[model samples]
Target: MEEYEIAIIGGGPAGIMAAIAASQNSSSVVLLEKNSSLGRKFLLTGGGRCNITNQKPIKKLLNIYPQKNFLKHSFFTFTNEMLLSLFQDKGLNFIEEDEGRIFPMSEKSSDVLDILTDYLDDVVITYNFEVSSITDDFIINDKIKADKIILATGGITYPQTGCNIKNYSLTSQPLTDIKYGLVPLITKEDLSDIAGITLYDVVISYKKSKVKGNVLFSHVGLTGPGIINLSNEISQGLDYNLLENDPDFDIEIAIDLCPDFTREDLKEKFTNDFQLKGKTMLKNYLKLFLTNNFIDFFLAQSDLDGEIQLSKINKKSKNRLIENLKRFAFEITDFNRDLSKVTIGGVDLDNINPKTMESTLIPNLYFAGEVLDLHGPTGGYNLKIAFSTGYLAGLSASEK
Candidate 1:
């Protein structure tokens, strides 16, 4: 039987960090991965650039977690700064973006994983060795024995990157309630016609919840960060069904095609324009205020001829146009179908010790990454959780 002080599973960010941390604490560490190379998911993160972490403080970082207590416990020891410093000390320097998102100076996730590999020289790693099962005493490597085990296996997302479906199987730890977060939403419109067109500075709202920012039409649905933030709320049981099925599902999006102008200001401008070219059709008059296609559609909906004089426009028609500008609604039918961007659920947080990430049900057991039901938005927050929790698990395993 081959014996070691620590055994870490899954060589993603968490597993790599655990191996480095555990080995530094005078424990013989072994990291097991099924992929031919380490950090397959890491390479794909942030669209291959890898948003390593956010420049947010510890308190701010804690706010990003869906479950606060879990993050509070795990982050006490290994923090966002500590993780950045660790990488920096290892020669993987990082820079922050406009939104405080941190990325490697090299602009490559591959560089981050390379640094980890260099740091884990003393830690044994077995690639292409998919972990079939785990027991208290050994990892069953040709009947080999391991002293301590750490399961850093990720969740159901990105199955192509070697996600273990059996991660939740045979677990004595309770799973945390998981649901989709930070994904796009599908709408009833045939957005494919305007798929490449982006709507900027628009107010998108449902019920009392609303966000005014940039959004883009996709072939499948609506996207962009604004929509993604809303998608999380919807997937986590926000009643978007009312916006999907109800014929009266009127989601009022104030497309301030000109948000810079108030209604009164717009009305004044229209009055002056009508005075200058009262003979011009309403469509020609409004063409300056809207896209050509939108103006045509608005005119058609208002039951007005494009070439009609502005003097002939009735109060009812003007009010209707104003209403259309202020309250454009789109029916939403479904949520994002991209499974890779979602973490539906994981190990329940109640049964686990947040401080050490240890299972109260089993001795010498630990969990990290998406398996624990902790996730954040599309930022680097999710990966940060994986690193912090893994550090706690490795430290606790070494102590035991």
Candidate 2:
């Protein structure tokens, strides 16, 4: 068996970063990827443009993950600005879009992938290599020996990308609670007719939890970053107990169509509109606040006649209309059937050092990326975690 100083498993951002960092000073390193090509999933992020990382301030960037304190060392070591600079230093230009999302100037994920892979230089890349098992000494498919190994195999989010369903530490490590995060929800509302209707600046709330973003009507259900955020928060066990007994609990989230305006504020607006334009058709007045399809559907839900004059509506009916407009509820049956953005839980943070990402339980066993239990919502935060931790792990593992 050919032994190496370090072997980084999985070729995603974390593994690739690990290889780069490990080989910085001519340290022997090998990257094993099961896929025929590298970064198949990386090419799918941010609609193929690849939201490289957020350009948020150091303060905001540090608090993005659930284990915020656990990642303090890594985040500060390889910050958002540093991550951006790393790419820019390589002559790769990027553009800052909405929400501080940075993307390649070419606006193509392929370009981003090219830049990342180019950094590997002389690092050994073994494609189409799958390690069937991992032991104390490190073995790969009964071939190469990686004395010191960094497990960067991502979770089973995009299984098509070669992520194994088996949790590597199920037997030894206790906390490997895996669930999908940052995925679009499968809602109970059938807005097929109103599909493609976008509600800007809406607050999607499930009980005490809430997220604000544009909500898009998908044929299957609700989608968009706002809904995906709620899904991530929910998968973290925030509202997971709603299904404890039944295991198929139907949860409903309230969509505040107008987040800036309060329920009382909307009531006043509707009441005043009814008084001033009493002769105006209710449908026409509603058009100011809602989409035509929404007005049609909401008007029916309110049990009020859209064709009738606004002034003709009674006080009780007027209150009902205000409630429907303010807190429109939608049943979330399940998560997206299409693809899960990130995997939620992983090897517990307690078992690994925050500074080095090296396992406290087993010597020389390091972990980085989603496998480390550090994850966040979409828009480049998760990728940052992968890169930062991988850098630390690789640098630390190379040490004597």
Candidate 3:
């Protein structure tokens, strides 16, 4: 067997960081990946321009993680400042966006990957080798053995990115369920005919829940940063209600097209437009507020005539219009988990020592990245978690 001081599995951001951190401190490090090349998914992050990390303060960043406790110790070990320095030292500077979202200075994920790969020049890498099993005795053919192992295999999202099934199903310590995020949502409405209709400045909210954000309607369903945040909540509800076959865990999603305007303001605007341009059709008049197709559809659904004169408008029609604008509700019939952003449940956090990311059940075994039960909303939160955890995992493994 080809024995080494460290054996790191997966070549995504977390795996790569583990390899780099471990190799920088000690020699005899081997990074194993099942893909033809490293950073397969990394290349497609942030719409091909990877969002590296958030520029938010450490305290604020902690709030982003659903499992914040899992990150508590790791953050103290390798802070975001450390992460920034690591990249900047390798010539990959980051720039902050509107909401403090940090992206590569070159605005290219490839640059981020190149820097990591370049920094880990001394670490040996084995590509196209799927890890079927891992044991304390030794790793199987494609021979590699080590004093410690770090599993950084990612979650179920973007399965096409060469993420192996075995990563979530390692014979030694398997993971739980995985969910998707940062992907388009499937709505109850038959949006197949109206795909591509983009409604801007809309407020989407889940009734009586803390979930709410901007919503965009698409042919597949609804999508936006807001919907992805709600997926985690909805997935948990489903898991708890699994036994109730007829359980209706449906969520009522509301859309406010003109969130800034009150019902009276909208009514007054409609009345003013009607009296000012009495000859113009209602469809033609409302086109300025929304797209023509959407305005036509809204009017059609309200059973209101567009060409009718201002004098013909009544109280009932005006009330219906205001109601539609203020509260447009859609029943979430079924949720598609295939396109979620992060894997929700994983190798339970309780089983791993948060301080070192080392497995409490199995000594010398560590887990990092999406393989652990930690995820956050889009905005460079997930990547931050990966770096912090992987750094701790690498340091802990190397010390042992």
The top-ranked prediction according to TM-score is 2
Residues 349-397 of candidate 1 have per-residue lDDT tens digits of 7777887777787777777777777888767888888888888888888
**Winner on TM-score (2 vs 3):** 2
Full ranking by TM-score: 2, 3, 1
Task: For residues 1-400, write the lDDT of model 3, one tens digit per residue.
Answer: 7888888988998999888888878888999888999999888888789988888888888888778877988887888788888778867788889778998879999988888888788899999988887766657444787778898988867778876445665746645555444555566767766566777667766645445465666776877676767666666555432212322446676777777899889988888876787777667766766766677667776678877766567879878877887877767766554555666667878789998889898888899988887888888888888888988898888877
> How many backbone collisions does model 2 have?
0
Ten-residue stretch with the least lDDT total in model 2: 238-247
How much lDDT does each candidate structure score?
Answer: 0.72, 0.80, 0.77
CA deviation > 4 Å runs, candidate 1: 136-144, 238-324
Q: Report lDDT (Cα) of residue 292, candidate 1.
A: 66
Q: Of the candidates numbered 1 and 3, which has the greater TM-score value?
A: 3
Deviation from native of the Cα of residue 336 in model 3, angstroms = 5.1
Q: List the residue pairs that clash in candidate 1.
A: 174-348, 175-347, 175-348, 176-346, 176-347, 176-348, 178-344, 178-345, 179-344
lDDT of 2 by residue, 295-391 (tens): 8877775688989998898888888777877788887888773477887777889899888988888888889998767788878888888889988
Q: How does model 2 score by TM-score?
A: 0.94
* TM-scores, each model vs. reference: 0.82, 0.94, 0.88
Which residue ranges in model 3 land beyond 4 Å of their true spot? 136-142, 171-176, 192-194, 210-213, 240-252, 262-281, 284-293, 331-338
